[model samples]
Target chain A: MADTSSPPALHFTGHRHLVERLVLSTLTGRPIRVTKIRSSSVTDPGLAPYEVSFLRLLEAVTNGSQIEFSYTGTALAYRPGLITGSAAGHGASIDGVLRHEIPASCTRGVSYFLLPLCLLAPFSKSPVNVLFTGPGVITSATPTGDVSVDTVRTAILPIYEQFGIMNKLEIRTTQRSNPGPGGKGGTGEVQLIFGHQVRLPKTVHLLNPGRVKSIRGVAYATGVSGANNARMIEAARGVLNPFVPDTRIFSENTAAGFVPAPERNNAAAKRKMGVGFGLSLVAETSTGVRFSADVAVPVEGGVPPEDIGRKCAFQLLEAVEKGGCVDVVAAFTALTLMAMGSEDVGRIQIGRDVLGSEDIVQLARDFKTFGLSGWGLRDAGEGSEDIIVSIVGRGVGNVGRKVA
Target chain B: MPSLAPLGKRKRPTEAPKSAPATKPAPGTKAAEPESDGDSDLQAIFKRAFEAKFAPLPFAPAADEGNHESAEEEDEDEDEWTGFDSESESESESVPAPVVVVHSTPSRALEIDKSELKAFLSSKPPTAAKPTPFPSSGPKPTPAEDEDSAANLKNDVALQRLLSESHLLSADRTSGALDPTGKNRHKALDLRLQALGAKGSLFKQEKMPMAHRKGIVRKGAERETKRRKEAKEAGIVLEVAQKAKGKSVGRRERAVDAPAVGRFRGGTLVLNSRDVASIEGPKFKSKGKGKRRR
Candidate 1:
């Protein structure tokens, strides 16, 4: 038995103070509208007002805690989208005889020729700092030019992958004159624009250098005449899109109905062949959030009970990944028919008996309320009890099933 | 011994001068002799004067004869009062007794007159003074007085009984005794009364039965026992829960992916959207173009 001594009541008084402090700091940094604020009895009153509110929200959503809120105005929920980009720049300088003579030449050829020469030139004995500024700041500087873009897309990659989002990449370059007077006038700029987008088989890591190397030849240039600048930006944006996918997928699968008796059986045996089908449902609530659920039922004599169970389990797993609701009642009804014997016609056991009258009524109500238009179901084989059912909704839906 | 010498030559005759009685008498020797003579003469004079002053003078012959006649008449009066003179010799012997008798009769006569005066005063009226009885030579004992003594003795006995009862009661209260040896019923009764008085004050006019007091005490004991048991059970459960929670928290900590901001010792960089756009566009373009030109 669970030792249920009285747990101390949560005093929210302490959280009030903490919430105030947190809200003050957040407001000081940036103005934000407080759409809803709730204080839970379980929260410590010492918590800052903002922190307490945030924690209370977290508890309410995750722990099934009831929450009450006084909202001042409508709160805008943030819709997360894919974010993608690349860290790119160059760092080098020419000095002494080569630096002096390169700019002295009048022809563009000489200037262009000097580029490769600088690339091939021996390392300078004198060290000079080369600062590269771009879309992402260089958090740290090393002699070797390496940069990192630490943003939300990169931070939430794992969460995105769990939802089955994919990432793709692209790169591009541009040309411009060096700002310094040393150049003849025109200079070539190799702008490596990294682009990414969601793709299938979400397990793939977009930030992997190997993936970047594979996509090197694909310039990913969209149609734009003489618009080198626009091309570069598009290429970078494209690379970043695949880095974070904004799409969400939800799906579920289940089996329904009973099997028929042997051919030689009497009228009672013929009655055993019940109507049941497999069902699968998938729905996407948001670009990156999906909900799915599934249920499967066995057909007597047509399919093995183990097979039916495995199919049902697989349907549920698929639904879970989809992150949506399922029509549990219909799925259970179908499963019960499949489990019925030919001799047991007109008998259904739900919650310890053949589908109880109340259970049937509840099943119908559940179906009517949560059933989506695009739900799917499929039977395993002709005269076989094997069936799959799937349904999807905004989020995880009602989960109910008869043990029998 | 009187060796006189000049002051200057005193030293020369110093031994001789000192021999002037090697000890000349003390300075007041001559004056002391005269004072001693005067003291002896004064003492002799005082003795003579004291003798002359205390000597009694001789009586006159006539006064002696008068006193003799008064003595003879007193003898005659005595002889007359004696009515019987037995033998002459017996009479002579009884003569002295008659003189005593004669003198006593006069005194008797004076006492009779005083008695008569007292009688006359006493007989005068109803307002006569009652003779006051003389104080008894020793303390007069009364039955009431004896009763008082008896009461005192009883009080001592009562006091001793009370003291013993108190000692026993205190011991009983501390030792939790309902009844001790039954030798002294009175002591027991007293103890019981004291206990009742103490218990009575705690309640209103309605006396609390002994059984009810026991019931209340027993109930309190039962409640204490139950509370202790509950506390022990709660403590064990809390300990287990705490340990389980700690393990779970440790696992969660291991699973957490530390934010990149954690490495930002100086401060995390918060680049504005404009800054990011500039760097990604013109900055990249500038670097690329410069490379191409070179």
Candidate 2:
């Protein structure tokens, strides 16, 4: 690992880089300064409540973190002070955990703030349990690129599992609240419980995603006629039933982990009801690689449900055909994990033109910022297959994770 | 966590895994290298890949327990930072103390039942049961009706069976059809089987599948369907629960399903889930082909 003793201060404009910057800064013990948030954009300028709430949430996790925000709300200086985990001699027992149940500000998805926690949880001295209250489903009002259970399940979980730290992962949607964009309901609550301590990931070479083994999905309707769920399943299945060998769809009545379907009295509930429907599909390969795609029912109509189903099915097909251990969306996330893993060979197959994408290449640059090395982006040399981003974690791992 | 081993061991190109491009070997890692041979990872990957592809896949990938310890006496003293201060720094004041717990949420630890945990680790929703991890009998027969055609089956065991009948001619080739390239003599036999039709069956659509015809989702889809049925029964169950609790007003909720409109609480917890419908792969390829070809 490179020395972080004198790493320069990080500067950013707008709130876009907030999560990534915090995640990296926390690990490296560096300070970050974010300035001019939405100064250029006149429409809804300055920091939103969600951003402030995000900072407050961060404060709740750490013991003594310094956060200085400008009066105009344009400039903010954050110096990570203390990480709250476990006490000494408590390093080996997984029982030592710092639990914080936060009432997440409803302006955005909990996934936005959850990323930093997920990344930092492994390295924290103790396991972390954060219960967030926010819109459980992604909506137009939510910030763009906010992750959900979909990405958390397919992207983050797999990366942690490779580190032999999977036994404790739990992200159950305990309660469904107000659907986002516009709706009136109780705020949804999701409890994300994970980690005892970081199990430094071993060197991995995940080049091939292998063949698609099974494709399954769920179609649910909320505040609308339950029949909509049936239509979605039928339409999605119509598109998926030709190529996939094993396909299944769950409806409002059958989707797993749900408390149970509620009666839809559109006339009675009226304005209180938020009408929406969606489908979630996962294409799992023989090699343990999973590609997931989903579609939410649109507020506007005439866009057939068949198209939604077809889009999801094809997205998964592309993922499998791309032949990577990680899906395209998950490629960067996996690279981030590799950069932060143990000091052994780690490799992942991102797309052939992965380096063409600026964000993907930024991963290498970000690793450099953390003062970690023995990593690079290189051609897998299999005649234009997905490029493999390789790394050796500084072996920076925490102790005292008890396996309950 | 990596133990501080002696650093500055010269690079062994022959030992590095082929799959890994170990660029810019850092100063702090070689000392803590646990595997005796670096090439072992490359070999293990190839072996695992071969087994995963060639043999049946239900056989899980093996875990390397780091047994390859080879004692090597260091010849040269390493760089100044090679002796590494990881141990001391790890125990620094920045260490997080396990306090400040908010008792609002459920404080359940990872005491998951083994069977239940396995299913969760499988990454399926809670409704999905644990997949049977084994191959029965001699050669595992590839089941009829790949996932594509199986969606329509939807728990109609009879319909599912009909969709997957052996459509091709028997190995004996009594029907005088030429064998195809695939290992299965009846690979496309179902089509011909349907064409030939069952004895005394009048119409093409009227013909029923052989009672024993198989499907790949022998257990899974059945269980999924059964689960779906049970979930449907949950409505009645929900009513029962409501009657038992005698609460007629509040709306019910389901996990990852459609949003259940609970009685409008003043405080709304708005967590957003991303819609997975967006992808234009073909358009992306065509648009980027010329720009990315080089």
Q: For this target, which candidate reaches the highest DockQ against the unseen true structure?
A: 2
Worst 10 residues of 2 chain B by lDDT: B101-110
* Angstrom error at residue A393, model 2: 1.3
List CA RMSD, all candidates: 62.4, 35.0
- Per-model DockQ: 0.00, 0.02
Docking class of 1: incorrect
Residue-level lDDT tens digits of model 2 in A71-178: 878788887744554332332224443333333224445565566677777766555666664323332112243434544554456566665566677676544322
DockQ of 1: 0.00
**Model 2 Cα shift for residue A142 (angstroms):** 6.3
